[model samples]
Target: MENRSDEFSQKLLNEMNALYSLLLLFFYLITQIIAIYVNFCLVVMVFRTIKDEYKYPYYPLLFLIMFSNVLFVAMTTAIAVLGGLSRIVPALAKSFPVLIMIAISYPTVICVLDFLLCIHRFSVMFWDSEFWSIHVRWKGPLIFLITLPFVVLISSISITYSSLLVGVEIDAFGVGNLPLYCFISDIALKSLLGFLTFVGYVLILLRVAQQNRKVGKFTDFTVIEQAFPIACFQLISSILTVFMHMGVHRSAWSFAKVCLLKYAFTQLLCIVVPISIIIGNQNRRKKFRYFCVCLKPNQVEPANHRVCITMSNNRTSTTETSF
Candidate 1:
């Protein structure tokens, strides 16, 4: 009797675990799909609206950030969905080199971009130089071009090092159990960049305070407001990554929980910039809405109205009008 009871309990537990994994996968797929859509919309919106202005640097910087995010999120979503499907068919477990490339490259690009954004915000707001006011149009793209070589070099080194992670098993949900040493090395680099970005933002804030005191009103805070959420996420996500790393060496159950939390934060990172832009800036929000509209204005407009004007010669002209 006791043997039968034990078998029953084990079977029940196995079923529950299966159910949990299924639910977790559903959550991941849905959230990541939404994130991909949002990030892509932001990319299109920026591309359509980019133009010459003193604050123009922010647009290209933002465009690159969202463009990278759209690609990364789409790749991750595919991997995650396949990760779940692989359980039912072992053939789906095939790993690809692009997975390794993305794992090593995406964070490097994002962290660097985040820091550049902070620097842009700092320079534009804190400095009164002619270069920032007049030449930022070309300077933004120049800096991005210069930074590319270093990012590629660093990512190549990391990928080579990652290849040395023998028997690094990726879970059914596509999360890798990276060794603490590997995780820390990557996190340390990101943390250093994040720290510098935080410092830049702090200096900009102090400068804003000083200017506000003199002018007796808030001045040039829009960009700062837009950047604040991203900076906070960088700090919070780093701390979460540390905790997630700690769980990687533990039990599989614990690691599964960590992966769910990691996905939540990852998707949240993809969504943050879009939400920030939509809420913090009016023009970008309008542009984003414009991009999201499905029907053409002429198709969606109400029935056209006709108007007639009579010229001095008693000639009548008719025009169709639409709003």
Candidate 2:
């Protein structure tokens, strides 16, 4: 009786664990789908809404970031899903390293682009530079041209590095051994970019404070104020992911748990950027709400329904006005 009871208890525990795994897998799939959809919408919205007055490298950079984010989320999802599939089909495991490389490359570009976007915003807000205004026509194209080489170089290196790994072991969670240099290089680059982006935010806030003091009272910084939290969340989400990867060496957490945590961090980062863009900016929010919330496509069109993009001391703000 005692032996039978012990066997029964162990079987129950196994069943419970299997159920939890299925639930977590379902969650990963759902979040990945949501991330991909949201980022794609943001890309479309940013592109379609560009007007003559919206001429700035800021919008272009934003479009690039969202586009990269969509690819990043998609690649990560593919890695995870394929990694699981490789368990049943051994041939699939061979492609895991290549998938890993594709996944790593995007986030590196994202970090660099984030830093560049921050610098551009800082320049326009802190210096109130005429440079962005004066060179408006060429600046956007120039920024893209300049960014292309870095993208190519990073992607090339990632491909080369993944090719170098032999007998790579991929776990069910798609976690695998990265070359030590590749691992350290990735972490270093992201840390540096993240720090610089934070500093840029600080300088922008200081500029806002200076303006407030000159006015002898507080002034509205609604847009900048809203953006601050979103930026912080992105940074924190990114930092936690790095820490989670680092903790893999020290902690006894299972590979599945580590992978899930990393996925959650990444998915949250991807989802939040679009959400912040839609919710933090008044114009984008109204446009998003109008299109997404309204059921009837033929709803009466309002007069003067236009989105105006304005750059002030802190950042570009979108305001929609309708008569």
Candidate 3:
């Protein structure tokens, strides 16, 4: 009986492993596809539509965000692909400094950019004239430019230090990792930031609620609502990251497995902003309607979406407005 049980358990485990492997490979391919198609479309559309944001106070921040999303997809896909080839080709793996820089530096910049993005929304939503108008002139863009290098600098040091602690094991990480301790720390830093940003969003939402009660003040939820999608995801991702990392490491998941999980969630992160922004912009959404005739040209985005993009918890669009 004992021997039979052991055999059954082994067989089950093997079957599960095989399934996981197939799924992971599928995910990797999807990541590449998303990187090329989605990011490419986003890049072109954003630059083409650059002039549209001229009057919008939060436009520069969106530009930074769109640029980061483009970088996020492209850089992550490159890292995932090259990181795999590197493992097979030891010479390429030795290119750690460059790989490490791109891997850690970029997303860390993104996390900061996201937080700044949150901060930007908060300012505009709450302080339309006092803080926002002032910031909009030169302060917002200037601050983003000034702070970017420092964020990257901090990220490089963290990656380098962590690598020193656990050796440069840069194996296919789109948004996440090293040895157990090192990996935990990496996730911890991002999650902590995500948490803070999430809290910031909630606060902004509460403030918006308050503002709704008041009159005479010009308060639209446009910027705040646009940001809510990311803010919500950041909080969710932070928790998910910690959970997924623990599971992957304890099971001794392969580099590809790790990358797949990261890629899946991170790709969603890359997608949400562009989708939300585009949907909010009447012109861009019109452009989408033009391209995707499957969608009703008269079909409207989610209501309250000039300020928020809400959908059913389990909704899949046959149209472009799904996001």
Candidate 4:
């Protein structure tokens, strides 16, 4: 009877693991597509704006954030796909530690980038001259250097603690049980960074909005307003991550679902932010549309002859008459 009960328990666990692996595979593919698309669009948009001579010094920081997301998705998808396969074939399980390290570093890098972006935005709104003077460009590299040691220290401590809690489980057959290192500690750190980012964004937006209100000008405030969607996206993603950590202690399947939902929402944010900006700003949208139209072979015009001569002739005649 005891042997039969053990068999039943093993069967149930295997079934749950299979379901969880399938869900991870699905989310991995979806996030990879979304991350690539969004990163490409963001790069195009950033370059286009730069070409147009809109020198918001904080722009590069935003690019870094998008770049970090791209890296995050790439690392996560690789791990999910490989880890899922490893479940079926123990031979591929050796890479599990590297996968965990990638997973831990991906979000850590993103959180650091997000915090840097917040600081950049705050400086732009509140200390424009000083930001541009010497600190603007150096800030990103500085933050990276400062955060590296802390990340290493905290990650080391977390891994050690986690391993102690759930010792390294290895089967006689060479397949090892993966350690849940950095999961909880990383979430705690990210939640704190997310909160700071949210507050910084809110304060910057409020300041920008107030300035616009006083001057009765709205154009500059558009960017601030558009940023609200991204802010909300970050907030929601952070909350979901916290919930996922909580769920993991209860049931691994529940935790996997939460992770899937988190990535889905992140992809939604990636696609929605750029679309929102293009839709909300009519002038920029029109300019982009016109640019696209001009890309067609038949639509191209010689630069010297593109402008009608009539307007120039009229202006010349007016000058002659004045003389």
Backbone clashes per model, in order?
0, 0, 0, 0
For 61-161, candidate 1 gives per-residue lDDT tens digits of 66676677777777876875676676744323233334445545566567777787787677677676565454655676677779777665555454333
lDDT of 3 by residue, 50-132 (tens): 78665676677767777888876767566656767755544433442354456555545566666766776766665666555
Off by over 4 Å in 2: 1-23, 73-99, 128-178, 216-230, 250-260, 291-323
| Model 2: colliding residue pairs | none
Clash pairs (backbone) in predicted model 3:
none
Q: List the residue pairs that clash in candidate 1.
A: none
Estimate the TM-score of every prediction: 0.64, 0.62, 0.64, 0.61
The model with the greater TM-score, 2 or 3, is 3
Which consecutive 10 residues in model 2 have the weakest lDDT in total? 293-302
Report how far residue 116 has shifted in candidate 2, in Å: 1.0
Global local distance difference test of model 1: 0.60
Local error of candidate 1 at residue 151 (angstroms):
4.3
